[model samples]
Structures are given as structure tokens and as C-alpha cells.
Target: MRPLTDQEMKVVLDKLANYMSDLKSLIAPLEDGDRYVFRLNHNRVYYVKLSLANLATCVGRDALLSLGTCLGKMTKSGKFRLHITALPILARGARHKIWVKENGAQPFLYGSNIVKAHVGRWSEDCPEHQGCVVYSMADIPLGFGVTARSTTEARRLDPTGIVCFRQADCGEYLRDEDTLFAG
Candidate 1:
């Protein structure tokens, strides 16, 4: 990954602005601390690690590691895209949530798409391709997904098939996590 160009930075800033209104202010500090870009190919930044002065600025804080991290990708046309991680979603600031039961949540964390049958309830306004926080029945955030279909279409689809595409989940980063089940 590479540090985004000024134009690319503006695109990322606009996308994240919805969730983090103060994202631009963090850029200077991020540059000063430690800046490294993990890229998928040669142009897109997939993960970014940066520092922050206060824990309130981000989800995790450790003296040995940088905080205020984000996961993103570059579009085929070279536009930067950002997605929220499970850690930050747990902070309770996420706007869209797709609620699932234990059975569904388990598979989802293992990187399975949310089948229509397993979807219990969801934020009605969640649009396709937008990031949505996945919540367990108990209201704990399980991970994040990009909506594959609109609310109305999802409700109309066959219940046994996939609905939302999984992005990242708690299991991949947490232990006791059995690998994704073949079933």
C-alpha cells in the first residue's frame, strides 16, 4: 500500500466523514507517527496504521502499536474505498446494523454471507454497497458487510440464499475462533 495522493486522500476523507467528522484532523498526526500502506495490488491501500493522541479518537490503543487504523481498497477505476472494522463498530457509533441470531452470527463470523433466511432484522435504509455493522441477537457487533441488495429486495429474495456479502468479522482477528466451517 502507498500513502494516497492528495486527490485520493480527499476521496477517503469524504467517505469516512459520515462516520468520523474529524478524520481530516487525524491525518497530520497519522503522518507524524508511523505511516505504512498495505495494498492489495499496487494502487489500493487495504489497511492503514496510524497514531492518535487520545483513545477517544479511535477504537484501540497500545503503546507498541499504532491506533486509528482503517481498512480500505482501491476501485477498479482507482477510487479509494474505506470500510469500518469490527472493533470500531463495537464502539456503538455505526449507523446501519443487520441483526442476526447465534446460529447465523456464528457462520457470519466464519466469513459466510448472511443468507436471507437468517436475517432477523436490519436497518431499513441500508443501501447496497454501503458498509453495515452486523450485530448478534444480544446486540454485540459481530462484524461488517457490504449490502448486496436493497432492503426491499433482500426481503423479497429466497430465504435460503445469500443476502449480504461478508467483509470482515471478529473471528478472523480473535482466537478460539475455529476456522470457517466447510458446511
Candidate 2:
């Protein structure tokens, strides 16, 4: 509701840094470009190992779309599990002020009220908070940046490369199709 002050920004940034480190560690065992599928409880979790360069590409492509791209980037194996890399992290980068606005990023820049490298999405409706979360170009570090905002305005805001979804009670996304979904 109110502007994010300098102190608030730092806290979120701290969270993002720890998150990225944990994420990097998680994927460290997997070879670069390798994808993994894990079944957590009855739900499925997909992961892919990727570098910063590949992450940049995803940001460029998914930045302008109205609905954040879904599991289009997931690599499929067997029948249930899908493999995906740090698309969510890339997505947070794409929206970072540091990445600079690429093609089709204007509209998204205007509406969002928040953007931070450490804020990750807990629900399907995440990102595109416009200048509210906009971080300085120098604030981003070379790792995964989590992005988030209130669920109420998610559909209306359009930060570039944001992911949008409505989750079911079972923790499974009803449907997802990001540009990166396995080809």
C-alpha cells in the first residue's frame, strides 16, 4: 500500500540472495542443461539446470505477454514429471530494473507496484507489479531473483516476464504452459 523504503528493499534483497544460493546448490549436482523431475507428495516438481545466459533468453521472450508464460519451458519425461530450469528466477530478472526494458516491456513497467530480486511466487498469480517493486539497475546480482506481489492485483499488473496461475488446493497448478515448456 505504501512505497517500499530503502530498509524494506534490503530485507527482501537478503531473502532473494539466500534463495538464489539455495537454488544454485540444489541444481549444482545436475549437469548444466540437465533437467530433472521429482514427485513431491502427490504433486510433481520440475527442475532444469541452466546458466545465466539461457535465463536471459527466456526473459527476452516472455517479457511482454499479458499472462506470464507457464510450463512451456518444461521438458517432459515419462508421463507425469517435467523438467525446467530457473525460469522463475529468470522471470524475476527480466523484470528487474537492472535488466533494462527489452521489447514489449513498457506496459508491464507502468502498472506493477513492487519488484524485487528476492521475492518469489508462492501462488500462481505473481509478478508484474510495475514501478512499485522496481529495483535499481545496479541492485540485481548474478543469481536467481525471486519476485512477488499481492495476489489481488496480479492479473491487472503487467511486469515483463511475470508468471500467472490459479492454484488448486492440492498444490498443483490447474494448467501451465510457459514458452519454455518442453519441446
Candidate 3:
């Protein structure tokens, strides 16, 4: 594993900023005392402590399956794709969020797009095509997706109109059990 290059860091930060407005606030907690660091292994970005990362260097690359929290992976085309596993971290700093109604929770968990009627509440400033975290009425993080319409536009949409397009949902853990963490 190796530290992310300047270019890689920029790509990762830009992608993360899509979900959260302040990149510094999102990354501040992870850099406390330089105790933690981000590393790249198998193209996957991991948030690991410095000591553990040092120890991991002794192990062969192929033998090391994982380390710390798997933030996501860098694609061949140089794009950073956020993974479902990073939900908790992202949710903590989410600028815009959508709260799904009880009846809509199940369908969202099933990987369906959120519809206008299913929205319990949402950040009023959420813009169309912007990334936002999805939550249950109880405030549980369910997933993240891009808004299909702005709050103003959605207010006039029919109940069946799509509000947010599903990108990745928590249900993938169960639906893709075998391959979820495969190398």
C-alpha cells in the first residue's frame, strides 16, 4: 500500500465534496496527531492508523486483503467511486439529506429510486443532480444518491415522479454477500 498522490488526493476530495460541503471538516477528524493516514491498496483507498499501516508493510501485497476502513476505490479511468462502506463517514458530514418515509424505506433499501411521495423531509437547499445522503425517518443512514430535481421543482412534481436516483444502497451488503469484499 502507498500514500495517495497529489492528483489522487484531489480526485478523492472532489468526489467527497459532492456529498459534503466542507472537505476540511470531513477530513479533520481522521488526521488527528497524524495518527491516522489514508493509503491505497489494490486501487482501494483505506483510512488506517499510521502504526497499523507501518505493520502492514511487512505483509505481501497479495496476502493483505484489507486494512482499516475501505473508503472506496480509484477506477481505471481516474475517477473515484465512493463505496457503500463509506456511508457512516459521509453521513457525518453530509450537507444535504433526504429523509424517507416509513413506507418508502423498504423500497429504497431494495435499491429503488426515491419518489416524491416517499420523501418525509429533505434539505431545502438540495439542488438537482447534487449528491445527498438518504436517511430513514428515524435518522438512520440508508444510502446515498443524486437528486433528480431541486426542492422547488420537486414541490410541483407528481407523487410518482422520481426525487433521487439511487446510486448505492446498504442492501448491497446482503444482496451481494459473496462478492461484496472480494479481491
User: TM-scores across all candidates?
Assistant: 0.59, 0.19, 0.93
Q: For candidate 1, what is the lDDT?
A: 0.60
lDDT of 1 by residue, 92-172 (tens): 566577888777988897778999888889888767776677888788877777788888788889988676788777876
- Candidate 2 yields a Cα-based lDDT of 0.30
- The residue-by-residue lDDT of candidate 2 on 10-51, one tens digit each, is 443343342233334433455555543221111222222234
Model 3: residues with Cα > 4 Å off, grouped in runs: 29-34
User: Total clashing residue pairs per candidate?
Assistant: 1, 30, 0
Q: Which candidate number has the best TM-score?
A: 3
Local distance difference test, per candidate? 0.60, 0.30, 0.89
